[model samples]
Target: MVWIPGGTFEMGSDEFEDSKPVHSVTVNGFWMDEHEVTNAQFAEFVKATGYITDAEKPLKPEDYPDVDPEKLKPGSAVFTPPTHPVSLDNPMLWWEYAYGANWKHPLGATSTIEGKDNEPVVQVSYNDAQAYASWAGKRLPTEAEWEIAARQGKPATIYYWGDSLKPKGQWPANIFQGDFPWQNTAEDGFTGVAPVKSFPPNAYGLYDMEGNVWEWCADFYRPDSYTKNAEINPKGPSSSFDPEEPGAVKRVQRGGSFLCSDQYCIRYKAGSRGKGEVSSGGNNLGFRCVKDK
Candidate 1:
């Protein structure tokens, strides 16, 4: 395991109500994967462990009563643009929970990973990621560790690199450009996820910590928990909640995905955090590995 020497740094922010009172945090040394786990890597894990992703497993009737039995087959979420305007509050407006889509088939029923062996594996649930990490002898980074490394040794700035959204006219991160939802300039060289390590690494040699895809963390999300937390290695709230969802079973996801647009959701910022269903997976979600001494 490659060790990342730990030290003190400011965590969280005062921008959002949840991110109030930025405080110091001292992390102990822990090893972490330089980048997100990729398709090829996961393939090997599956070959060796015969591990089945959540999407591949059949859905129990009790678990998904509303889902059509036929649609319960292996699948993943694929971005589906609305033919007309949609409710921004409801993500299902633009996100289609397609059938026959998984890590192997990212774009619902037809897409395959034939040429994207190096790209970070998508459509992996928290359990799927944990399974892969366990097989690889690693673990997911705590949200604190993720935040510290994402800052890349710099003081907490809005963006990972600096305060400037577009420094010197360079699209440093892979984010949506132009009109968003309706139109993307692809000015960042990519309208969708670029392969892992496609962009320059941060000061700590970590890649894709900002844009590309939202990475999973071990912490249970607490939007307001940061307002009153300890200074050292705070582990977030005991649980999470999303009133929109049926039953609250959400987990923390950091580093906004390619779908993030300033005009829509300005969640691409370093401090901006969101939660995912604990057992969910989508085209714009992936996971990196971490280790503790």
Candidate 2:
């Protein structure tokens, strides 16, 4: 946990009605990881707690109705860059359904974690990150805390760095710089997920707060909550419909993932967000732990 000297930050965005009434909020001092927890860190947690991630557990046939028992084998999300252009309307243009992908094997059956010692561990669910955080004696940060640390601008700017996406001809963070998903120019020195601290830290010294992988937040997601309430220290919605599950879920994911792009989900900014069932895991989602002071 790294100490963050927090202060008042203007929250939300007026450009979008949901992020309107950009209000100011203050946060006390707290601790946050320098980067998203890496595979090595997750491995340490597993070693200390004998924890098994949900992706490693087999999926029962009933759980995925109509799924082949063999097809239910452990897997994770894998991004297979296309050799040519694909439909812009479809996100699946780059993300493939690998049969045996996981944190250890991000590229499905053919891949292994043989060399990725510092990359942020992907394929982790909200519950998976929570368990690890609990073991580490920390908790996920609230959305307010996350955004405060992701101070790209002087609080009110739409982006963390400034009003300009590419400030002074410099790439602010590690995001896809070429054609989204497919034709990555690797202008950011990476084609897929890069090392944990591959990019420079934010104003608050938080690494990868804008891109890399979406960090799971401890709040429930409420896409419309900001529009309906005060923007000060908003904790997301109390609850919401989770199409990924059978009932309401209570988790918020921020910071955006490598899969995020202007061509697809332009959620790599400080204000971007997404969530999932607590028990579900994907190849692009991971988290970092935070502790209150």
Candidate 3:
């Protein structure tokens, strides 16, 4: 874990609607994981506690009463890129719900984590992340803490490293480098999720703070969260609300994923925000932990 010496920093960006109206925020110092939780770390937790992630558990019939009984199988959303150029408007073209896709089988039931223990574990829901944090005697970081840590005492810029996407003509983080969904040139040396610390660490020595995988945070997501005034150690809104999906409860997710691209989702920009349904897990989402200091 790295000691994040927290202080006041700009908390939002003008690049996105939800992150609009940039604001100031303050936070206290905390010990944060230097990198996202890896397959080895999570495997230890599961082996010790016999924990079952939400992706591995069968969906309760009562939870999806309207859905077909046969469809309520254990699985998660996997990023299945299209073979040809497709409209970016519909993400369903590239995202498919793969039955039996869980943290153990990142891509699907047939996929395995063998020899890839250093890679960040994906397909972990917000609830599953919380469970791992509890077992490790740590907690998910607040959105504020996460932002400041990612900033690394540097001024706000498009990329955590700086305004340039690639500093000195080298990929500083793992992000999509080619056409969205259809092709990934792997210019960053990674076509899929990169192993933790594969890229250079931020100024604060935190790895994968901007990419690799979307990280779960400890806050209820609200589109207008920045509008509310909680300058110091803001824990986010009291409740979750996404005008687009009001019925689904969501938690704040930070950092972006390997799928992020300039042609599509650019939430990897500094101060930008991401949110995910609490009960949902995906191949591009995972989390790290933080300890109070």
Candidate 4:
């Protein structure tokens, strides 16, 4: 873990609608994990508690009565890029509900962690992450804490490193290097999840803080969260709300993922934000933990 000194800085971005109304935020010094939780770490937590992630639990028809029961089978969303370019408007083109896809089987039943123990554990729901944090005697970082750590006492720019995606023609993080969902040049030496510390650490000595995988934060999703604008360590909205998906309870996700590309999802930027259903986990979503000073 690394220590993040308390300070105030601008939060949110004007580039995205949800990250608008950039405002001032203050946070206190705290200890944070230097990288996303790895598969090996999560495996230990599960072994100790006999824990089962939400993705492994069967979905009840009553919870999703409108959907087909067959499609509601236990699964998590996986990114299977197409051979050719497809409609960017439809997320279904790349996201597939892969049955048996959990942290253990990231790609599906046919996949396994195998020798990738150092890779960040994906397909972990917010609850699963919370449970792991609890077992470790830590807690999920608030969105404010996450941003502060990611920024590393630097001025807000397009990314944690700087405004340029690839500064000095060098890839600072692991992000999709080609046309998203259809092409990947692997310019950063990875088409999928890379091992922890695969990229350079931020100014605060935090690794994989910009890309590689999206990280869960302890905050409910709300477009107008900035409006609340608590000056000292704002803890996010009291409840979740997303106008796009009103029925689903969502939590904030930060740092983006390897799937993020400038041509499509540019969420890897420092000031950008993302959200996911509390019960839903994806092959690109994971989390880290924090502790009090």
Candidate 5:
């Protein structure tokens, strides 16, 4: 864990509507994991407690009664891009709900993490992440703490490294490089989630703080929460709501993921906001932990 000597910094961004108003936030020091929690770490937690992640357990009919019972089998969302270009208007173009996909089988039943223990574990829901954090005697960072750590004293910069996405043609993090959701040039030396610490660390020595996977934060997401946030140590909104999808309650997600692209999802930016259904998990969603100091 790295000790982040947090202070006041401008949170959110003027570029995006949800991240608007550019509020100033103050955070206290905290000990943050240097990298996103890895497969090996999560495996130990599961082995110790004999725990099963949401993706590994059978999806209950009562939870999703509207969907086909056959489609409600144990599974998670996987990014299976189309062979040809598809419209970006629909997210289902590349997201396939693989019945056997879970943290153990990242891609599906046939996939394994035999030699990839250090890679960040994906297909974990907000509850799963919270469970792991609780077992580890740590907690997921609040949205403010996450932003403060990702900023690493460089609060106003667009990217963690700097304002430029790639300075001198050097990609500082793992992200989609090509036309987005269609072609990936692999310019960042990664086609999907790269191994933790595969890229340069932030100023505070936190690795994968901007990419690799969208990290779960300890906050119920509300699109307009920032407008009502406390000036100091704001946790998040009292409840979760997304105007675009008001039916689903969402938790905050940060950093972005390997699937994020400049042309499509520019959420890789330090100030960009991401959220997901509390019960939903995805191949590009994972989490890290933090301890209050």
Candidate 6:
């Protein structure tokens, strides 16, 4: 864990609608994981507690009453890129609900984490992340804490490293470097989620703060969250609200993921925000932990 000496910093960006009204936020010092939780770490938690992640649990028929009985099986959203270019309008083109896809089998039931213990564990829901944090005696960082830590005492810039997308002609973070939802040139030395600390750490010595995998945060997501006044240690809105999906409850997710690309999703940029339904998990999403100081 790294000690994040928190202070006031600009917490939002005007570039994105949800992150509009760039605001100042203050936070206290806290100990944050230097990298996202890895397969090894999560494996230990599961072995010790015999914990069953959300992706591995059977779906309650009552919870998904409207869905087909067969479709309610245990699984998660996996990023299955198309062989050819496809319209980015609908994410369904590249995302599929793979049955038996869980943290243990990141890609699907046949995939294994045997040689990828150091990689960040994906396919974990908000509830699963919370469970791991609790077992580790830590908690997920609040959205304010997460943004401030990612800033790393530096002034707001397009990227965490600097204003340039690729500083000094080198990939500073793991992000898509080719066409969206199709071909990935892997110009960043990674076609998917890179192992933790594979890229240069931020000024605060934190790894994968901008990409690698979208990280779960401890806050209910609201599209208009920035419009509300929360100058100090803001814990986000009291409830989740996304105008696009009003019925779905979502939590704030930060750091973006390897799938992010300039041609499509650019949420990896500093101060940008991401959100996912609390019950949903995906191959490109994971989380880190923070301890109160």
Residue lDDT tens for model 5, 171-261 = 9888898876878889999999889989878879999888789999998998888899998999998999899898888999999899888
CA deviation > 4 Å runs, candidate 4: 68-71
How far is 266's C-alpha from truth in model 1 (Å)? 1.9
Q: Write the per-residue lDDT of candidate 2 for residues 35-150, one digit (tens) a residue.
A: 99998988888888888887777778876798778778776667777888788777677776676777777777677777788999988888888899999999888878887777
* TM-score of candidate 2 to 2 decimals: 0.89
Instruction: In angstroms, give how far residue 64 of model 2 lies from its true place.
Output: 2.1
Model 2 stretches astray by more than 4 angstroms: 16-21, 228-234, 242-250
Q: Could you give candidate 4's per-residue lDDT for residues 30-77 as a string of tens digits?
A: 999999999999999999999999999999999888999888888899
Better by lDDT, candidate 5 or 3: 3
Name the lDDT of candidate 1: 0.81
Per-model lDDT: 0.81, 0.75, 0.93, 0.93, 0.90, 0.92
On the 0 to 100 scale, the lDDT of residue 115 in model 3 is 93
Error of 6 at 63 (Å): 3.6
If scored against the real structure, what TM-score would every candidate get? 0.93, 0.89, 0.98, 0.98, 0.97, 0.98
Mark the regions of model 5 whose C-alpha exceeds 4 Å error after superposition: none
**lDDT of each residue in 156-240, candidate 1, tens digit only:** 6878889998999898888888765766789989878789888888888888888888899888766666765666777777877
TM-score between model 3 and native: 0.98
Question: Would you give me the overall lDDT of model 5?
Answer: 0.90
Report the CA-based lDDT of candidate 4 relative to the real structure.
0.93
- Per-candidate clashes come to 3, 5, 0, 0, 0, 0
Question: Cα lDDT for residue 263, model 6?
Answer: 87
**Residue lDDT tens for model 6, 5-75:** 97999888999999989987899999999999999999999999999989998888898889988888889
Screening candidate 2 with a backbone cut-off below 3 angstroms (N, C-alpha, C), the clashing residue pairs are 13-19, 76-101, 152-160, 152-161, 153-160
In angstroms, give how far residue 21 of model 4 lies from its true place. 0.8
